[model samples]
Target chain A: MSTTARTVVELIVNNHPGVMSHVTGLFSRRAFNLEGILCGEIGNGTQSKVYLLVNNDDRLEQIVCQLEKLYDVKEVSVRDDYDNTIFTRLHDLVTNAQ
Target chain B: MKLSGAEIIINLLERQGIDTIAGIPGGSNLPLYNALFKSKIIRHILVRQEQAGGFLAQGMARSTGKTAVCFATSGPGAVNLITAIADARLDSVPIVAITGQVAHSLIGTDAFQEVDTYGMTVPITKCNFLVRSAAELLTVIPEAFRIAASGRPGPVLIDVPKDVQLQQIEFNTWPQPGKKEGLAYFDNDALLRAAAMINEAKRPVIYAGGGAMYSGISKEVIKLAEKNGIPATLTLMGLGLMPHDHPLYLGMLGMHGARYTNNIVHESDLLIALGVRFDDRATGKLAEFCPSAKVIHIDIDKSEIGKLRRPEVGITGDLAAVLPVLVDLVGADKREEWVKRVETEKQKYPWSSQNADDGMHPLEIIKEIAAASNDDAIVTTDVGQHQMWVAQGYPVKSPRTLLSSGGLGTMGFGLPAALGAALANPKKQVICFTGDGSILMNIQELATLDEHKLNVKIILFNNGYLGLVRQQQELFFEKNYIASHFKSNPNFTAIAEGFGIEAYQVDSIGDLKTTLPLVMAKDGPALINIYVDHTHNVLPMVPPGAANLQMIGG
Candidate 1:
């Protein structure tokens, strides 16, 4: 069995109707699947934070580079060393609820 | 001045210079249709299905390089347009899709004809809007057009609730259309570095893509290649960038590319990829693609520069702006020895067939079409063996004339898109090159063709099987052909006649030669069905998961 590492990509984008689609559609069009995604409106409600959990591969850097090119995307950063326990915890809560 | 939301939307579209729209009307969108009747400025072409409307808009946008609009009512009408919207997004075609919604008061109540349009379209559109009030329509209408046509163009959706369309608001002044801005950002240092790489390379190849044609910079790209005496190979989307007869032009390079072209790319020392994302189909088994070449990637979209393969120099700017600067810096130089080597490979594996006397060949039919049209016709194709055959056999002399579903590989795009192209360029001859299987996917659009009486010539390659899939199964699955063959196919000529289109059927080369000229001169829609050899396969095909150099059968 092979092991795959997961990394979180954090993005700050203008809070608008299609910003999320533009960001995520880029990955889907490239045939890259995201593991998990978390998003909500943040500071002053004008901007939103989007966290995308994706496999850590050589293609990750390229995906991050593409995310930065979006017109509505204010900033993008790859948080490789950040704690990923939040996803694991959420997964467990959903499984327990089911 | 007081105006209803529907009126405001129609007036704003007129301000954007939109004189034509493709759409269908339903209950939820009756108010907008009512407003459209009052205005004689916008001519609405009624399409039978909502999806065809979307592709019709795509045809106009792609053919003219302008923002086109399409409309659909709530529920299934909106949902049916999803495939075409996604196609536009993948291919970067600029289109605005206006969809109607249930009344605002019916939010989340599972009301009649109400579905989550905003939620369903978010992942497919460049941007989408769900207007809350009638006053918001003022800003949303113009913004949708702006976002759709702006940097790296794609489709945008605006879903207005029925109640908002009925509401009225007063405003003294109308919102002006936004000014267009260029997305390219010049970087001189990177240009110099790329120039230096070009000057030092012994074996260089220019890889051009769809973005080059989208930006109308094929002249600059061709100039750079000719100035440096470098051979150029186009991606599927970049087919018409260089004239087919240009000396330095190698045919498309990818899985189904010419054997010599793939060999040249593999042996090259430098690759100047412009506006091309190193897609997997274009670069079979990435590890071995351009193995010895150092890449210099340039694109308007920053992320595309280093997304696939890490380039030695990545310039994130417009090709129109960057290519000229790089050409000036590099100046003129010649690599005769490299050009000679490419010629040697081309001679070693010539694109000629020995089966011309056996039966009707698809390449012969394409060549016949090319001869009759003088290589100047706007050729759109559906995906499959026929698409590849057209790519190989047809000689495209100009850019934007060869339109196909490149990135998305969507079938059923040709017929409706040809309708759109014919409408955009009324004087130009448009031809739809499709296969038996693909033509049936959206055959309903024949009614639209009959209604408009558009002069679109349909060339159908009938093999009675899903040719590409059958070929794959024959090679990989030990000839276990299941669900690949048509037990009994319809008489396409009869079907075309029923649709009021002039029709002909050809089973031999002689028939094709005689029928082609007569059909070409015909003033209305015509369908020429050419039956091809069922066992004949596209040559020089690089199998999946293999390197470009590992192609079998030339």
Candidate 2:
């Protein structure tokens, strides 16, 4: 059986060479294999949304705390409202379809 | 009562006891750099990229145990720094990363040089702040430092919007007191139970981690381990937590752990894990690992307990706090049989290349480097086979003497990390141990070293290949050396010279002995490229998914 774990991280960054470089650099450094990453604009012109899927849930707490300390990062939340909202949305869609 | 965001940042850093800054400026952060031009209170290091700036901060933090700061501009510049920031967080180094954001109004309009840097770093920092208003600057700057330098120290980020940078605010005379309760506290009950378990076990072992070094509790850890007559083993990050030559020392324990250390871990009745997160690399096949032992896990992070392999006794507090209690409770008693058994094992598989009299082995090179340094120098290494060899062969006499990538295993970590260490502790000699493959990753840092004239010795173990990858290929892929071999490699000695660093090339053991002393004597940064046979391998490696005892070497 294939092994798997899940973690969610939110990043707030200023859009720009090495921003992606910095993020990818971190993942490689921590040896945290990313399952998936989704990013988008948020909060009216000042911030963006980054949803990271990491393989190690155990390290999420520390990872989240550390992420909050980066220069361009405004805040970092490991367990955000997005998970619940997504779950609720999925549930609503299933019920309405039925 | 007027100040630019950059001026406020420099002033805040000076207030927090930071005298040096490492960074590069881009269009977005130019205003701050302009402000820094007039400030003499803080020294700014103009690095080529923000990535190296972060690593330099990490090295400074690692050596000094103080929060080091780095800066960058928006877009790629800010992002380039994430690697080093995550490295600091994972290794528990106190670091502060400051990046310039594009104008707040253009954040979502996809303006030039605008990227979501704050969003990108959310997963790798302890806390981060976006300076939406100049009024918040005084409060946020000091808070970031407090958080980064506090218990279980790690990285913190502060993003300054361009508008905020151009605004003005009154500097506060006194910053708010940092959170106190969030800090870890030792429970007396857990400490008592841990002591009792150690007292009862016949074959007990102490597994120390980087926390011991971070807390400056190596002596306390050694005292407790010695009092109970427990054999001690350290994680790669925990190198120098105890003297490698100490009688109870069992070398590093992990995937490339010594054969006897792994065997003893398997046979022990009790294992005292201190400040170590049970990383998969350390505890191979966790279910089958140390099955007979009653585990006692002690760490500052409570979540680390019962997360991987459940421990019978979990003590969530600083190692510095609990180690003394353990020593006092468990009085000194010599376990002659246990000590004798470990001594016998040590004799059986000594960590040396005794048979190599003519050819230069990596282990021999590491030993010579350690011997020449007087055991008082600080040694750091980048990841790969060379890192393991250094961990296995170097006889460390003091704590905080060895710094290397443990959880991250970043390949190009050595040179930049050594630069940071050298800058942090100017009085002591610092050395960088790296493989030929790993060294090329950030070889440009040679310019940074030469610019500052740092006294860091770079020892490049050149085997004409990615030695670790080649070893893995040989062990797992039927010896099919595909892309692992590098046929036309740049002469590192010449490259160092090109970057203005003194360089040397050693081909034989005789040449190595003659050149090593000269390299050691140089007052500025120097690189010694040692060409070894491509056939050398790091031994005692455990096959993936196998029991710890089923190691390759004797």
Candidate 3:
């Protein structure tokens, strides 16, 4: 497969009721179907990290920016390059699911 | 101990800056209605049906850009309003729908008028909540508003059980929303590459979509089109992106779109798809769509790109951000040959139609409506032949000026949508063009319009039949009318009158000429029923599953 250049969006959000709904709502409204989303708790259960991998770097940034403006969002970062580490983690998940 | 749930609802709505609510009272919501009578804080608009309430609320939301609220009882009442909410959601109109559920004790027992209202609404709404307790109603009220207005703007549902509506919850100032987490960082490098593709391509076309209108980037879209010497085509939802009269404007594209527009898109070297999803209607047999084009798809949604068709370059950023850069990067060279080629094609395959005007032509009616309304007036339409006629005949110059259920052509969409538009912008005139069949779906909304005193001009095209279905019969079904004709068509003017709305009937051209000006000048909701030929059809139609060149007429 041709290694397509992609972008990654990392979201840090408050662990609260309706936060996931709101976050998912943004993606649904934007029509951005997440290719890969990995979510887990990061700090003392108050916040968590959400990883979204999109093929287009420009799109990744845009999603990050919009996510940043949400009330429950603590921080957003866009990795323009498809980091091998994230892919490895995703690959592991697929392997685990299988 | 038993302060009614409806009372709490009234108190909560008053706190959320809602002075009025449009809805129908049903068995499940009767308690709420009883409580509403006791509260001096809010005005209740008792519409005839739940659907009208939904549309009225949508109208209010569109006018104010605030969350318009509606109420209904369980089951069919809630379900009846579903189409309107879907309409609002698809058009990005902000609305908050609150439904009354059965008492907690009867929950899941399949009690009278019980249905999974929340489950039914999930796909259409931005978010939904079923308040398990009255303590949550206060929170749900403000949260519903916040969610409906926060990002791209859409409908939200809060289904409150009867028992919860009676429970007491302490009211406080709405909490300041927590911080948003992430940064959307656009890759300047990707934009540069997309810009390079645009600059290098000789046949560049900007296919603007509903996203452009929603993002408020119409001006930017026009600037980019003008700057790059690019001919532009708008999706049905993107009708007003470039002024209809602009030299580069190629009109709407897709199945029913202009032949030249689709042909150019097919042959173009660079396709800049902005704020538009590659819907099947727009793409028309996607395997062969834009076969030669290197697409630069600019959308806020990450999933849209490559979902239907892969783009050469995809920028998932706001049209606000990407459009400016695209406009700035374009060179000073005008594609004169390209412009002439498009114009020649447009003339060759123009969006024209002709009908023997035995009495009234739908196109002429739409044209007159467009001409009479000022630039400030907003026009909305329901689906069918009337919608296509409006699209072809109406010359929209401003973005968001025309609101229609393009993605979901829900019949009976126009009246309520126009009500929402008129309510959204109270100062601006709003008109809804609804066909006879489409209007009957939610015709009771005429009473909703009457009760609210909303200044909406409704142009009801009474053809005594489903014109689109009739057209299909003519072309494919051997002209056998079948179930298409409503031989027992009700007198719409009398129906409007019964609803306490001013009504005018026009059967002749002279009657239309005399009545249109008078109705346009009047205040409050007025219905003008123009008797059109049942046999008259919208022409220049691409027969189903046919190429653009195989249009019925032009």
Candidate 4:
């Protein structure tokens, strides 16, 4: 098993049609890959919380900074304590299924 | 009123005042194309490739500062559009790309021409959508335009399934266009602090970027610089924010920037960076960049404030809104000694190309083009030595006149983008300055140019090599030239002639001077192949990982 240090970037964004695209596009254009993602409406449904699991790299800081620049992205936080085992479990299930 | 998804999309596009769109049709998007055929208001331009379609939209958007549109089919078509979408994202060009997708029922079943476009485009677009039903089209279409055009403009994608386009939906009224809200918060304290720094600083340099161009605050920026007597430098994307020959304007900074400009930035006590992210290329080595300066970073995007270099005072607001306030707060105080010192250095270390009396120099040709066009022509360039030469030699008089892929450094951007610019502004002359290697990447667009008869003058600097890459090899790898040189080159003139455009070939300096005017004077599309020396290099180049001050050559 490859044990790489990973972090979950939680974002509070406007729950709109293209908001997810803006957030994910920032990472993609920078060539940063996402390991896992979970998003759902939060509060009164005007905003949503997006959790992005990504490999902790040198460029991660820059990516985090860029995410905060988006107009629709209300808040961004890098959570080191978030559980990454969900991604590993999903990966294992997918590999074992075939 | 009841309308199909295709009708809603066409109606929305027409409502948005979008008259021109560049794209290629395919199987999945046939319904949308069918709807497009029924509408006479919006004209769809057929491009040779999907990438050209995206770049064509970029050219129009960057030229007009308005949201531009492009369309592509599912899978391969969408994949091809990714490069341009990435380009638009990095450079902050407003483009909305509508792509076809496999029907919802077939999605994730690995159906023919099925790719998860929504998943793939997440990282490249400002925003993207996967519409499951036709009813979603009403809101999605207008939202795509709004998001793409507002607050740090970028590309947005709408991935519609075939079934969704064919589905019918009844609507009482079309969704009204969303009004772009002003920035919710402005730090008055940060503005005052920045003003204080500017007032106290002995040597201040105003560094501008694409944000200044986007905000249309060139006049305010120039006023701020002149009012306080600060020398201004621009990033590659920030070119044309100030007139090329403006008294206080220092040419482009970082990498292939002027040596004196880089030195001036290094020597400054305070750096007023506006609408400019300190990109890696613009700041060679981050630690060493502007080492002596205390930065006052101002941008609409708050995240860009301390992303690379932590600023002493960071003000987040629109350049258009923030600059006028800063101008009023900052008292006019001339730094005579500092200005004189910078002027002395500028004269001391002049940027000059290698003089070759026998053949046409690339810089000379650029100057001739600038002269013939009166520095008012909208110029677009592909990434290479010729791009650097154009940045150095050509004098841009206004913003949106010079468009190039700065952040992504995408090649083959010139021709397609020039096509967009020409189509957007029918009255203005659009010129494409490209290298032999770069031009070949999207040379098929010459057919589009020939068909439209766009007044785009293409000047190809044929050096028979990937000149910039070769220069890097020569300097860094002990001249071990690998795949950089092209041994057998095609006749570009014949290629242009095959496309039914008037073509000229210039091998000498006199020929270039005489041929350029003749080509410029000609009404329709024309191509001029100017053979340049293969060994010529864009000098004052900062090597990879080197500091901005550690530039080599020239």
Candidate 5:
């Protein structure tokens, strides 16, 4: 019921230049919350797995639908049950690094 | 066969049946131009400015409902193309733009005339690509076309580095030419519920947008409006959906809409929104627009359904596939009382242009053009007061006949777009309505028109000022009138003649009777410069951040 509820959107996309921009630009352009992102190429370096920490707001469905429309974005899934600390622990890691 | 990247790009475009491409050549794109020189199947038009080339492609795309292509070099050329590409994106015109980027190895080094085109185009394009190798063109080129027109049409850009254009690859088999992706599957229960929503309403209104035209479903939507005795009001992009004289037609509804049309929409109990996004320009102060209405929205794009306004029943699919099903499912009714009320509202406040005394008023000029040209004639307009006047007064007989920059409201669109239309539909005349301010934005396109020798008649309204900005200043900013007035404007008739096209200078509406027929009947391009008074404002305007009901002038 909270507006600040956290979730992760996992994306399977083509591994190449400009794919990251296409994925991140969606959040910036639409003003959707993207608190954190984790990505890398997978399986023979032809595909990538991207995890975006975002707000679980009313716009999440529309956000997922828009992401699915991207040509390089092969698959999109919203993981409400995934451990969001994968992103939250980053704050502690950065503080300790300093 | 071994083919260079530039040759492969040209081959892919030719294989897609692209006959004409508008572009400008520079250092980065020299290789691509060299390949274009040998293509017997494709012809290129050299535009003076890079931005107009993008719009030239939009004209062909918007008028024909197909994906059109344009070309440009990197950096400045690609930057100049941003406005037109953004315009196409907002208006949903399908165009594939191929720009020549710097060498792939020198990408981050900031080499001469190099810019991150893929980065710049991300926000404005449906999707964009930075081609890394020559082999990638085999799939990327076709995919560009597919992604452009797949569902909701939009612009697509592919930035190819200079090195790639020279790189060669060998292949035995060619890939299939790209076509639009298949239509989405329909939900039967949504259609049934939408029909019930229409059947239950006592006072229903149909609000259609450019999607109706994009889907080529004008006849079905018009049938629904006529059969159910419901009034239909169109957005600026949707003007040609219904004939102007149709009894069920309620002109345009928005900021400058006829008082009655806006009032009727405000009072309606049901709004059947079709292929429309409910843009801010159409729904002034969205919180209060159609406050009493329950909406049933259908569009091809899924995100647009509830993006701005929530609908009682939302269906995400093409109107071509959706409208006919709803037509059969809903029971027809006269609803004479509601129709009578709408007619009375239309008569009482009425479109201000309806009572014109046949003078040199902009509305009269539009009517004169309508009278002189045949039904097949196409019209394109630039942004500002004249654009709104034409949208408010012109009698567009069919969809795609009226080409306008509705979503982005880009000035300088009329000239090049009209040129593209003239090139595409050579048999039909193209009438371009442009104001002095808008004309000067891309006035160099007159030379492109002269080179083609097509039938395009440019009607210029020389008001000696940015009329719309002046009007807004007068209303909203207490008539400060800063930077709105032009102390000196060019003699456009002389300018047109300098471009080697026929030109005429007229003073009054009576003068149009003589010059319009001569220009409209001529075989080649012409320009008619008519004198108009400045400070003339488009009326029935809703003040900034105000509701549709709170209007200041008519």
Candidate 6:
């Protein structure tokens, strides 16, 4: 995780239908803020990868712990080395659309 | 073997050794009921409502520490189960709730009795599933049970579409029943560190929560306390873990705790937290609870370790497995000074039960119930003054005997839960302590109790008001009582008689003293509506957001 405020979280989860709801619902229920999100089905489509942008605050450990407990979530990792441009571009696009 | 999804569910539950199931049937779940009718091994108890079905399942699960099953149909049926499911989540009770939904083809068309059962239950359940096909039932049924009964147990939901239930599937062999998975690992280094901390701390306290109750490590906990000269206090959910009169026991701590107990906990230099989440009710204020104490928290769930107050040494493992090693690792300390201080605090300010001999006080009633009933008789309580009083006053001898809705604090929990306890333990007696307000919420379950005639007793603390709310309003809200009072209180005795159960009333303290023991001794299901003055309040309450030490009125 960066000393900076923003960090990226990557999750490998089962690609079952309604699995996304479990992942995203957990973030909302725990009151963790998700700044940006990107996801796609991995090879064979049996599993999917999700990336979430969030602040690297004190609650980050708790956020990761809660994610690890989800039944569908297979793996969780914090990535300090990531392309910030992608999330910034997405934010810009949404701002322009509005 | 060729079987429908409904048949598979029944067959699987029977294989899991689930003999009794409770639920209300609807058009969507008729197929399951049909399968249930054919299965001679499994008996179904038809609850008056779907929520009661879930709570009834909880009654069985909480009493036995086993996974219990309940069923409901879609829409309103699924909606009603939310409170009970959420309650289970808060208390970490293991129950599997299966609900029926409309056909898959309907999609979001909003057909009759259609609701997004899966979506609604995601936040409440430990895990949930929406069966896409009948074939999924083979894996899903067993998986649901496994998830529900696994470490840090909580409710799980399975929503099967009506068409899926009718869809037939052929398989070579039936799948095995679901079994609970044990703790995979715990850090030995952390364990040793925890032991050293306990050995060194001068004034230590063991604070047990629901996890301790579920782990069945009462003996180990007591050993840890006795060896280290630590005083122990239980959360409401952990009341029965320490015997009511254990020498090292300091009773409950936090909101509605005795002043001395709360004070003693806050004064501790070391807090050994076991399977506890440090909830607001038990901690009063996060910053102020056990402020001087460095904690050693052991829970099966990892997320709870630093969720509220961070612990110095947190061991993420089951207490049943963790405590035995912990008991041996710690060196003994007399802690004469700490023990003397605890005793002095307790002696100087005794609990209401210590002095009050009034026959009509809830404390006396609870003590009398303990006297009349055998040591192991199960007790359940609705959320209110009576529940708090029972937590403070009842002499619960063992774990799983005192069942109350701790986290959710839901009313109407007592009656259906009592029904479940009675059903699960037909040979043993079960008692429900409810108030006039609480009883009315699920009063319809009396019919279920009457039909079964299992030895269950309903003791109603009739105060003609929402007693707890009224008390809070009196203390915190300036006593401008509006909706708290039930001016036209229904005669519960008459209502019980109408429901075809034996009923009695005791208005005076003298009558209450004479009649309670005899009523408790009677054989079949009975209800005793004992009139209580509304002025009586559960004491030693710490107003919300205050420190545990700032307790008021006992």
Candidate 3 lDDT, B501-526, residue by residue in tens = 99998877777777878888877889
Ranking by TM-score: 6, 5, 1, 4, 2, 3
Write candidate 2's Cα lDDT for B1-554 as tens digits.
66777778777777777778899999888888888888878888777777888888878878777788898999898888888887877888888898999888888898898888777776677666667877778788888877886767878889998888888766646565333224447888878888888888889989889887887888988888778788999988888889877878888897888888888888888999988887777878888888899999987766667767788998878777778777899857799898888888877876553436645888888878887774578888988988888888888778777888777777778888888888888888998999899988888788889999998999999988999899989998999999999988888888999999899998887888888898887688888999888887788788888778778864
**TM-score of predicted structure 4:** 0.91
Q: Give a tens-digit lDDT track for model 4, residues B127-171.
A: 778887899887888888888877788898999999998998888
lDDT of 1 by residue, B110-173 (tens): 9888889988887778778899899998888888888887667889999999999999999999
True contacts kept of 4: 0.62
lDDT of 6: 0.90
- Predictions in order: lDDT: 0.88, 0.80, 0.77, 0.89, 0.90, 0.90
Q: What's the residue-level lDDT of B293 in candidate 5?
A: 98
lDDT of 5 by residue, B1-554 (tens): 99999999999999999999999998788899999999999999998898999999998998899888889999999999889999999999999999999988888899999988889999899989889899999999999998899889999999999999999999988899988986858788988998998999999999999998899989998899988888999999898999888999998989888888889999999999999999988899999999999999999999998989999999999888899888888888889999999989877885764436648778888888889987888999999999989998899999999999998999999999999888888898899999999999999999999998978999898899898999999989988999999889887888899999899998877788988888877678999898887856787888867888887665
- Across B323-366, the per-residue lDDT of candidate 6 in tens digits comes to 99999999988889999999999888878644376667888877
Fill in the DockQ of model 5: 0.82
**Which consecutive 10 residues in model 2 chain A have the weakest lDDT in total?**
A79-88
Ranking under DockQ, best-scoring first?
Answer: 5, 6, 1, 4, 2, 3
TM-score of 1: 0.92
Fnat across every predicted model, in order = 0.56, 0.06, 0.00, 0.62, 0.94, 0.81
Q: How far is B456's C-alpha from truth in model 1 (Å)?
A: 0.2
TM-scores for every candidate against the unseen true structure: 0.92, 0.86, 0.81, 0.91, 0.97, 0.97
- Residue B47 shift from truth in candidate 1, angstroms: 1.4
What are the per-residue Cα lDDT tens digits for candidate 5 across A12-89? 999987788888888899988888999888999999999999888899988998898888899999998788886767
Q: Clash number for every model?
A: 0, 42, 27, 4, 0, 0
